[model samples]
Target: MSDFKVFPFETEKQWLKGRMIGIGGSDASAVVGLNPYKSNIELFEEKIGRKIPKDISDKPCVIYGKKAEEYIRELFKLDYPEYQVSHHEYHILQSLEYPFMQASLDGELVDQDGRKGILEIKTTNILQSMQYEKWKDRIPDNYYIQVLHYLLVTGWQFVVLRAHLNTEWGGEKRTTVKHYFIERSDVEDDLKMLLEEEKKFWEYVESGRKPPLILPEI
Candidate 1:
């Protein structure tokens, strides 16, 4: 059994506060300097409540993504009927072993065989979807890291990433769903490295010290 606890938050504000108390799946990529949109320093500033606040609520992409999440989840269920999908009641989970490590899962999956796994739903535009090959074999690094972070917190053996592609083809709007399975063992080494980085990052949060900004290599 996993030492994971789920906390029910009454409001979005409370949920945000809970998220600030620990490192989350979305924050994992930023902690490792892999999120192109955010840097480790920015994440540090946000966590510490510095002057600069990064907000994504008004972003069209973010808004669309949020709106498409449930549709994507349903698509996954339709494609994999053998698996039972259940939404997290509170959605916020913490690892007892590393209380500072947290996860916000989109859904939980139980296969007919009684195996459990995590489900992550994503919405990407057609152009972005085309950049990757088969999703079952490959995924964007940032998304991959996010899933690994969730697995770390939940101690799940595997994760299913379901993505909805919103695009137009031949003068018609289309929504296509794709899914990928990620086994924890296949990325154990990578997760270990991320864990070390997260440990160091949390130290900065605890001490009110800022992590150095990572500049683009190019």
Candidate 2:
């Protein structure tokens, strides 16, 4: 029998590809988004068919390394805060012969107090009422594989999400934890799809073939 590996399809991969690029079609003076290199408000705005509102745009909320460390520390040591915790972001990358293979990771836990989890903290604006109730109750699809991906990177048995809720438009601050138990087989499936997509992506990069989506096949 032939031994060609099959790729596991992940919607996240298609999602990631789009984000890796620079902005798409947002006018600078009129748009409100992160001006940093990784911000793609213009491109993402085009895909979603809505102006990426300045309030909830993926602007630099917190820098991911030392700054992120300070943020976590503040969360843990703030004046009478709830659920003191710490976290960090790790870019898990398996390099090929040249460079790049499977690359993705939101954060890693070095001192989580025996908690094997990833913290996917999201901040949003509330026009009328607090929308955090939805995320508090359930970690939606956007953050599903993301949490799992962090778990896979850390080699943890399970993954949990610690979501911090805050609002720019007057809302109660809240915290919640959601758990996801993905098995070895599940992570393996994600990896296979990831590698396959990586190969195809490298091909595209070499040949200058633009791919519609670069999201992982989780």
Candidate 3:
């Protein structure tokens, strides 16, 4: 089992600052070069407090996603009546064994059998969501990495991803809900590799060294 320490903060701004102190789930994606919007070099600059021109979270899509999180969680509850879903009071968790590893989960879920797992809520435009075949089996790579990071930090056996797809149909707004269950055992090797890469990245952050930028493949 992984040991973790909860760092409770009074405000979102404080939480954001706390995140900079350690690598969180979102940062995990970038560290591993899976995040399309950000690269490892960019993350390195942010961690080292080099003034970045723009905050990705301030982007319109990201802002809308955050705003729709609550509604997405409620949708999950309504769809999965057998499961007990609860929100976490503390948004930040740091691994006691690996201080550089941390997680900020959206919520928690208890199955009908009382098995506990982490909940990750997401919102995306219909076009993006529909680009995939089945969400239950497949999700964007960056999002998958994010969830895996959470599982690694929380020592959870599994994670439930609930996504809301927004679309406009015939002048009317439509929202569709999809959920997926990802087991840690299914991605153990990948997580192990991710941990190693994150350890190296943390070293750069701690040493005030910038990591090499990952160029796009031809």
Candidate 4:
């Protein structure tokens, strides 16, 4: 709820370069060793310019998700009419309180009560039964860390994440869309914890010191 800054990028190159300046929502889980795809050491290396982050734009799943994002966001607006939805193209929100904290939101929301919230969209392939179970009663740990990072950066009142899960069963393809809501009031302690962890990670970056590798849970 303090002050923040909005940065606009005109090109993909600029956006990618800017991400190095801070810890982003996607980078949050990696910082805490919760992201299965990326490790804490990798994130640290990327932040310190020891390596360039891989470009996933050409990946099939990445391509599909990018193309589907706009349509899915439209569907969310139609389905959740109680909240006013809006989006800003190619802009990142940076926290003044914690300059190393940033958020690149899919969309934003304002409820009837004038409370502002975040809109996060995800598209993933559910290839196995275990993958589906991760979304059964709760958001996956990585995603929960992501939204919490967004909340920490923007200080939003709530978050609504819409996930589109694609799966194939018996040679038949199907898509299931699920929505989850998170209230900031319910996760104040989590926010505090994430902030502290992120601050420690950023310190390592600023000091040009490598942090100990944090392995993901199996």
Error (Å) of candidate 3 at residue 111 is 2.2
Q: lDDT per model, in order?
A: 0.82, 0.38, 0.81, 0.92
Candidate 1 residue 197 C-alpha distance from true site, Å: 0.8
Q: Pick the candidate with the highest TM-score.
A: 4
The TM-score obtained by model 1 is 0.88
Q: After superposition, how far is residue 176 of candidate 4 from its true place, in Å?
A: 1.1
- Which regions of candidate 1 fall more than 4 Å away from where they truly are? 128-137, 169-171, 216-218
Cα-based TM-score, every candidate: 0.88, 0.42, 0.88, 0.97
State the lDDT of candidate 4 residue by residue for 1-218, as single tens digits: 35579999998678877877899999999999999889989999988889988888899999999899999999998999999999987788899999889888999999999999999999999999999999998899999999999998887899999999999989999999999999999999998988898999999999999999888878
Give per-residue CA lDDT, model 3, range 112-136, as digits (tens).
Answer: 7777789998887765545545354
TM-score of 4: 0.97
Candidate 4 ranges beyond 4 A from true positions: none
Cα error of candidate 2 at position 14, Å: 27
The order of the candidates by TM-score, greatest first, is: 4, 1, 3, 2
Global Cα lDDT for candidate 3: 0.81
lDDT winner between 2 and 4, please give it: 4
Kindly list the per-residue Cα lDDT of model 1 for residues 33-132, writing each as its tens digit. Answer: 8887888898888888884556777899889987777777887788789889988544589999999999888889987778778999888766554454
